[model samples]
Target: MSKNKIITVQNVTVTISSEELDDYICITDIAGVKSDQSRSADIIRNWLRNRSTLEYLSVWEQLYNPKFKVFESEHFKKQAGLLTFTPSVSEWIEQTGAVGLYVKRGRFGGTYAHKDIAFEFASAISPTFKLYLIKEFQRLKEEENSKERLEWTAKRFLSKNNYLIQTDAVKNYLIPKSNYKDNLEWLAYAKEADILNVALFGFTAKAWRDANPEMAGKSNVRDFATVNELTVLSNLETHNAQMIREGRDKKERFTILKDIAEYQLDILNEAEKIKIEEKEETEETV
Candidate 1:
């Protein structure tokens, strides 16, 4: 998942900043859902002043955050639930070196917390709300994973068909004209196939195998191609077949096919970025 993955929990639109380490939920959005958007900061401070809240935060930081300032966390705990003990998200982060909470500024400004911390905060607001939040968040992740699988499968099918077409071209053109014995003519077909493979992947089949012996044993280089690479490869395969039928030599075809692969990959990659960015923008408004 991308960093900007958002999931709507009940009436709350929680943005999940999915990073390699952990997913952070927008605490401000969760606060807004429980009370009001304008009062989110005040609500957060109110929660922070509670003794239980500070204890929970301290335990969490101790467990998950190596750099957390346990001494300062103890100091904060000492003053918890006082008449003027309210703390902001920024204070928590600055004082305790807490990574569990974050306060972002600007148009989309808000406090965000790691999923574990956010869910705890939600429980303070309402237990039922936290349960619903968990459900929707799980559903959102499953849906995103499914969408990725579908796209990959679609690209795989197209590239597989393109590979088939290239094989037909090899049989029709290279096999008939080879000077090698009938059984040995298969080598010529393989050589011709590698021309397109090299043009798109930058490695001949044997070179790729030597470089990635374990992976190559189970899957070819094409199996691990990105969507953009696969899209360009499908097109390259079809074009290489046409060039082969025209009796182009490997040297000339490789030059032309390589250029096509580079150009199409660039175009397709840029288009894909634009498509994803537009979708993110639309989701923000909704």
Candidate 2:
């Protein structure tokens, strides 16, 4: 379940619910600020009757919601700005299959809208209120991003530590058995690490260096990895270390790690696709 956050603007408390990368703000709370709480739904209905609002909503749905009912939206478009064209948020959602706005029940219940739509709704309240809403929402997002950066740095550190564990396994189990001088021990470690590099990234450290010579001196492939890649890399390192202790050959370990990398990365990538979709939606809004 998504958690709800509260942000106050102009002394009115608004609830924000995060679903993956999309943020839904409580438009009902925003409406309450303009008038009384009981009239929030009426204010939203009046806003929905505007022709420009209908056009904007239709464009947004077309860009992001493949299943959006274009025919139904067109029906609404023709009636927009007409005195008889009053539409509720729930009615609009049900008719157009709109994903931008929704009504929740029970705890934290209200009419919630995507940040893009909520900002537009705030404009109807007043330009000043809209600006304040944007400012507070941006502040909340900045705080979240700061926490995420810290967490990512901690994960990267853990990945590096796990990498050391893998290298130590290579030094103890593989180095002594092979004919490698003390001066060449680092080569053995590098080669073992390459197995993981290739499994997760489809390239070795040297291959990455050769491809990007400018960055080679300053950073390696791991430095360019995404949070998801780093997470899988850490797991691959731990698994490779255990496999090394079990006397598994490089070829077998590589195959196993490759399979694990593909599986884990696929799941993580799927989970993160929402963020990418949200970015595209934001770009379209811009």
lDDT of 2 by residue, 244-276 (tens): 645576677777888999999999989889888
User: For model 1, how does the per-residue alpha-carbon lDDT over 98-176 read when each residue is reduced to its tens digit?
Assistant: 8888877775568888888889999988899899999998898799889977986886786656555565554233211
Regions of model 1 farther than 4 Å from truth: 151-286
lDDT value for candidate 1? 0.76
Which parts of model 2 have CA positions greater than 4 angstroms off? 167-228, 231-286
Report lDDT (CA) for all predictions: 0.76, 0.81
Q: Which ten residues in a row have the lowest lDDT in candidate 2?
A: 174-183
Model 2: how far is 84 from its true place, Å?
Answer: 2.8
Q: If candidate 2 were superposed on the true structure by all CA atoms, what would the RMSD be?
A: 17.8
